[model samples]
Target: MKYSELHGNIDRGFNVFLLILVSSIVFLLLNIFFYKFQDNISYFE
Candidate 1:
């Protein structure tokens, strides 16, 4: 029983960490794209 509880906790922690990591990467990529587009607009002007 104790082992199962520990395993469950570990799985939950890993899943949470994975979700945060994916969200951060997506946000970072979006911000990078936004900046790139802004720079292009300014350059065109």
Candidate 2:
């Protein structure tokens, strides 16, 4: 029972880590795309 509890805790920690990693990556990608779009609009103007 103790071992299962430890495993569950580890799983939860791993999931949280993965969620943070994925969100940061997506945020970075969106920022890059937004900057590129802004530059294109400014260039056209």
Candidate 3:
């Protein structure tokens, strides 16, 4: 019983870590895209 509980905790922690990693990656991609879009707009102006 104790082992299972510990395993469950670890699983939850891993899931949380994965979520944070994915969100950060997505945020980075969005920032890069926004900067590129702004550059294009300025180039046309």
- Quantify all predictions' global Cα lDDT against the true fold: 1.00, 1.00, 1.00
- Model 3 over residues 1-45: C-alpha lDDT tens digits? 999999999999999999999999999999999999999999999
**Model 1 lDDT per residue over 1-45, tens place:** 999999999999999999999999999999999999999999999
Winner by TM-score between candidate 2 and candidate 1:
2
Per residue, candidate 2 scores C-alpha lDDT tens digits across 1-45 of 999999999999999999999999999999999999999999999
Q: In candidate 2, how many Å is residue 30 off?
A: 0.3
Where in model 2 is the C-alpha error above 4 Å? none
Off by over 4 Å in 1: none
RMSD of each predicted structure: 0.7, 0.3, 0.3
Q: What is the lDDT of candidate 2?
A: 1.00
Clashes of 3: 0
Q: Give me the displacement of residue 6 in model 1, in angstroms.
A: 0.6
